[model samples]
Target chain A: MAFATIRDVAQKAGVSITAVSQILHGKGRFSDETKALVRKTVDELGYVPDSRAQGIRLSESRTVGLLVPDIRNPFFADLVSSMEEQLYEKGYSTLIGTSAEDVQRQDAFITTLLGQRIDGAIVVPEGADSPGIRSLIDRDLPLVFVDRTVEGLDTVPSVVSDPYPGIESAVDTLRQLGHRRVGFVAHSSLGSVNVNERETAFRAIAGELLGEDGAVVVDCDNSSRSRKDALMALLAEDATAMLCAYSPDAIALIGLLHDRGMDVGEDLSVVSFDDIDAFRLMSPQVAIISQQTADMGRQGVEMLLARIGAKRKRRAENRRIPTVFVQRGSVGVAPQAR
Target chain B: MAFATIRDVAQKAGVSITAVSQILHGKGRFSDETKALVRKTVDELGYVPDSRAQGIRLSESRTVGLLVPDIRNPFFADLVSSMEEQLYEKGYSTLIGTSAEDVQRQDAFITTLLGQRIDGAIVVPEGADSPGIRSLIDRDLPLVFVDRTVEGLDTVPSVVSDPYPGIESAVDTLRQLGHRRVGFVAHSSLGSVNVNERETAFRAIAGELLGEDGAVVVDCDNSSRSRKDALMALLAEDATAMLCAYSPDAIALIGLLHDRGMDVGEDLSVVSFDDIDAFRLMSPQVAIISQQTADMGRQGVEMLLARIGAKRKRRAENRRIPTVFVQRGSVGVAPQAR
Candidate 1:
């Protein structure tokens, strides 16, 4: 990196390289004035400790790593951007890694990141008890989980969005719109406690609000074709509204409905679980269960930084960010009500 | 970093640390079989050149870096993922960096990448005359420009989308729909040659398709508030259609129209310049001039790899991908035509 060299730093500080080095190493008989000048020049030049240098721990790597489940999902991508912005303000660069929701890839990524000399990490883990996660905890690395926390790794500080509030509100809103049967497009992946929690809440609220037969669950993998097929089947069964549990897949069902000559909000309403800016641009602005994603991201970074600085492990606790229902044009009156 | 140590490598290779060191340094009197065995073990261990070891240039870093204007842009994000998948097959990890459309940040990211011993780089530049880009070219680094190219860097290979065909198709589609006056909301950035090219194409096509005083251009400075004002002025002038030049700000104008009780596709027609998969989810499905972003990314990686292999500089050519117009329900008949 052509970030200012020590020699350049010395020249700018008006001191010998030896004096600068001595001051950096906390040695030699240098005046406080000389030290201050050297420090100022170093900061001005944005000179990081050379990664090539050995036996000298001049500085810890001022970088934090983040492992997200799926970078393609705008929800996670937006969250990462927020966390990155906060970490940048603290003078830390973010190294991002995406698991793509594959356990093998997630493990490989974790192994790869361990080679980068990152000071801390924030991960939306693939599975609660994945071997890679166990190894990470064993290493005592500074880590804060976000979005989803593993069952056994509860001791790690976590920031999660509770899905119950949003689910309850969505059910009530759909019921008021004269929808007696609302189908849910559920993510196929299991073993993720976050997904499981969302599924359970969706089932309970749907039954309570729309009757026992009102709750219809269609499961499909992350593939757009699979998700669309399941959704179509649910529609054939008289589902007036499709409440998509996953944000990335929300677009899939909408596109499918359009291709089939069905209009969203008018023919069939769609309430997406995770709200993002793009959803607002749609013709019938998508109603959503707004998870406080930005808040979760900010909290994750704050907790990670705290862990990085602490001499002892702090009491790990789950920081729950509540969700709210955002009504938009997507929640139109059902055909029965009309 | 918790990567395997040299001692671990020696053990796996069934050799002494000295023997491994000698073989790695090309100074050992070892049998060719032993050398091959050591190499095999090293590869299996996913080992990279030890950057910390002084005077040891063991292996070239098998990494390719990509710099995008904004990571939050799904267009760029999808392209990066595609390129990354391709590079991974060739045993190269992709290092991603974002300029966030800031020249200073772009330069800083470039400097940072230079320190990582990256084997090659693919960049969508901030401007034509960015000093950091010039320095990379001067150093004879293997580089490929994607999406946009800087004005004086004609010798650099670039993959750019040809906007003429898409513009022509869009104008023809609008004309068929009986739209006499079409107003465009264009991006505010001027230093970007890509934006300039699109603006030129849009003006020419709109003028040819719509009669005199039928084509209107309203400049927006990236703010939703100002963009809405400019769009309102265009609508006030009796424009039948509003075409957004930038995808990100497309929402602002659409949201404002919705708030004003004007329903898109019914009250007014609209078209978007760039299209992503998510756009299909929108109600009335946003019509767009589609740029083959994935193809551009795949081609960029191939061009970069080709550059990395050649000992001498090769001919630099612009690989232009054609664009197509994707129609949905957004286009409507003008009141006079109807």
Candidate 2:
């Protein structure tokens, strides 16, 4: 059986092909009588307009691409879920690609999305500046950055969390709880803006509370084993409490502490950023700087929609969402020197 | 800056517009020098090929639509992530829509995907014989079903889990633990193929072991409050142990049991399906019937790719991935005379 095209429907409905196309694409003007006739003919003939044909006629692909660092991370999952919800409401569909923190994979995904002629892209860049991403930007594609910001890029709309306040709050809480020698376990250096803000706030607060040499910062590669080693090194310095940069690293450190037979929040206090789902169900609750993942996702869709609507006119803007510190069982007074 | 059209590029490169278009679209053969000249001109002019024009000329959208029930569910997230991984490798972009388990929403998503002129679709239908899905099948659209199959839809390829052997193994394990009265709690009725298969297998095994009267089935709506009520009712019926049909239900039931001063695995044996991420980290590990979530995602992509490649020639087939029961601490003998 042959499928009815716009031409067939137009002939059946006794209208011009452009009229049928206009009605199907929801663009241009047509009489109510003609519209109803076209609609009726489309239904009766079971005509499903070829999307490829419509896309060609409109010069718009009507699709957006999203690149995430990882999907297994609940934070990213929640973000993607929220974004999908918002985008679905607006008649836009998202093509999500997980880079898994690999720069080459991220480049490959961007290239694929570009080749597909996606209307725009929202990416969580693997690092500060990606050459492929730069090329896409240079090609004048509409792009939005989410969660993490890429340095050396100008005037791209981005949605990120302010990590400073939360870090400062955690440090203040630690100081008030009589922690003098504090350590920090960071997965990476001050490359990511969020991480930099967190580190700056942590150091300033620690220095203000306990002189110049009171704070110890251990920078490790973003891996579970590296974090475990960093935590052990920090613990060896007689640092009574440690602040973890993120949830995955915090979880790994907790397991390491458990293996060493040291009780979390009792022998050594701990706090982490990013309150992942499993943390709530763990035996020893880890204090978390909760980035509003759902809000970030919702805002991302809003920002992208705004760009899509005003692509020809509007200038780019960066929006920062705030983070809150949730005090749980992982944080407490450091054990007194015996 | 004025955008360079195919005419401009062709004029500059001293070639026909059709030749330039062919080279840009990766079609029709061209000489090495001519191809290199056109490529250089396109790069110098920073010309972005209008996908709409290409679509009109070639009749291929280069897009695939994916419809999932819930993006929040880790199982679906894993499925989607893997599909994206494979599709990106094959130079196809995915447009994802979530139905949130609402049939109306599901229908709307299908209509939208069709409207966008997606080259093909992979859907996890909310239920069997949905009219919206049936319409796609009637149109002979390239389609594949994942996770759940719609009954009466014989012409679409489907990827689903085989629960019979998994349920049999789960029951056999309970039987070895001296459980005489075993209860099963599922999210829905026997209408869903996955739930129905597990329920049927459980009843057959229970009937053979402890007579027909010994088996109990509780149909709980996919909500925490409803699951709590259903679990309470099941526990009050003198059942020795219970099997939860899904992970979310298990998480809720375990928390409820703990709140009610009942000890899992000791006072009341419990087994759940879907070994979610948090389950492994939670203390007093929950016994789980683990589906190959990542495998499901990867295999679904392979099946969808095959359907896409053989759209004009292939017949429909149903592919089943096996499930395994991962024994943890949640199963044990019934408390003596309690």
DockQ of each: 0.17, 0.15
lDDT per residue as tens, model 2, B1-338: 33356788999999999999899778999998999999999766545465333242134555678888877777778777778777777877676767878887787666545445356788899875776786567545678888898777767888888776677787788877887788998766435667667777777767887787778888787556687779878878878789887666676676577556576788888888886765654445678887777777777777777766663648778888888888887788767533
Clashing pairs in 2: A51-B117, A56-B52
Superposition error at A180 for model 2 (Å): 5.7
Residue-level lDDT of model 2, residues A1-338, one tens digit each, is 23357888989999889888889778788888888889999866645455343232134556677888877677887888788777767766666667868887787666545545356788888875775676557546677899987776758889998887777788788878888889987756435566666777788878987778779998877555677679778888888888877566676676567556677788999888886755664445678888888888888878877776673746778888888889888788878733
Error of 1 at B313 (Å): 4.7
Instruction: Tell me the lDDT of candidate 2.
Output: 0.74
lDDT of 1 at B244: 75
Ten residues in sequence with the least summed lDDT for candidate 2 chain B = B51-60
